[model samples]
Target: MQNLFYALTFERTLDRYSQADTTEVDVTAKVDPAGRTAQLLSAFFGLDEGLPRIADWAVCDGAGGKDGMPVIFSHEVGLNTLEPGDFAIKRRSGKLGEVTCLTLAPADDPGELRTVLLAGQFGSESDPPVSVEITGDIISLDQSVTFKGAQVAVTPLEDGPSLVLAEKVPQGQWELGKAATGIPFGGGSGCPEGTAQVLRVTWEGGITKPDGNAADDQERKLYRVTIRQEDGSEETIAPMHLADTGDGDNNHKLCLDRTEPVKSIAFPAGGFTDPRGDLNPPTYIGVSQRLIDKQS
Candidate 1:
């Protein structure tokens, strides 16, 4: 058994003169009982000072079903029609939740403005429940709904080794180093023969405009190295280069083997520079590179 509570208030004008001279009266009531419906009653009689008399009243009920489900039922005692009004509800579901809004309109003239109510399970299964109404004016609802979609496909690219330079190098001098070593070519076991590799290098920093040449401020230089496989096809090696100014000393060098195939590489502006020390010119460098697969 579920208990219900109700409160109500109403206002009425007995006459034009009385209404013009007096303020509307307010009334409220609450009902608690084990029932599907509740009732409210009130009355007013003339006593002393007969200027004008009026009666106002209202009754509201709070209740729920056995399953704890939520429902809304509206009853009109004397009103046969209704105008416009807004309504909304929030509900939760397994791993999902939603809010719904619905609108109700008067059927036809002469026909009683019947109360319209919606009841349903909320969340992911279907559209959320909603309700709405408008009197003689227009009404609208703002809605934003979203749902998850399926995952799409992603193709895999061939795995080619990349080349990363060592972080620290011997002070004053530059040393060439390799991050990813190359595999021997074709034998049905490793890299195919005639498979060539290429490395494209771009110089970024380090003694820019050595003599203040026209390319002094360019801040970028490009170079390429390629290795051919026994099969005649080629696998390009990653490119290398220097970064822009501001990256320490910017004097750096990159080394690649005849077997290593370049995959992907990038030399962001100012990527390399000399290690922190008191050295004047600062021993550091920046460079960029790219490797492409060549068709046989």
Candidate 2:
């Protein structure tokens, strides 16, 4: 038998339709039992604490006869359903391994006015297997959860569009060299010591024929960056060639290859050679010194 220790808290307020109801609750419990399900259920309902532990619920191993397994217990505590004992459990497949620990935290949401975050670990003592988050927009594993190795993020574009970016550890410098005067390697004096970083950017363009169906092909674009140091010295790196991150919307990798601390970045308009051997139109995308400084 193992010991199960948990702390839970609940808070909610409702003021609408001539009704005002509010609840604030906090509970902490420690249970020693043979099964996690019983312990969780007992803690959730605040059942007899000192009673002898019981292992009534069967734990499934995702094999024969007990394939579809659910969390032993789950509770949704929203404005309409607010109580001290309400709690939630972030579940994972036991097939992965034995679950070690779990925790739930309330997250911030401007639209929903209520949100919960759940985190859990499996197998190892430290690595997190599942991360839960509730956002104003939507809840999803790719968008709201953090897993090992890689993570994906969504950034709202200035033009009212949304761009999804995946987190990647910037490894070796993809583009090495200096800043140039213009796109196509023509014009502007080159900065010999500069390096360039790469970032994957994905976007979808809706180009439809008169029939209103999306064109079969929509391509992604890549941009190379150059930075100027605070000391007025500029380092130039070769342009990076980003590849698809596979999420579909024109995903590309972003890399920064630099030699010195950056103070400013030059935003010039010129065409870049697309990986497909096509020339991309020129636009001004500036890199801020703050972004460069973040590298150090």
Winning model by lDDT: 2
- In the range 205-291, model 2's lDDT, one tens digit per residue, is 111122332112222222334456777766654333333222111223343454343322221222222212222233333331122
lDDT of 1 by residue, 153-204 (tens): 1111111111222221121222122221111110001112232232222221
Q: In candidate 1, how many Å is residue 119 off?
A: 13
lDDT of 2 at 153: 21
Q: What is the lDDT of residue 229 in candidate 1?
A: 68
Using all chains and alpha carbons, the TM-scores for the candidates as numbered come to 0.15, 0.24
How large is the C-alpha RMSD of every model relative to the true structure? 34.8, 22.0
Report the alpha-carbon TM-score of model 1 versus the true structure. 0.15
Cα lDDT, all candidates: 0.20, 0.23
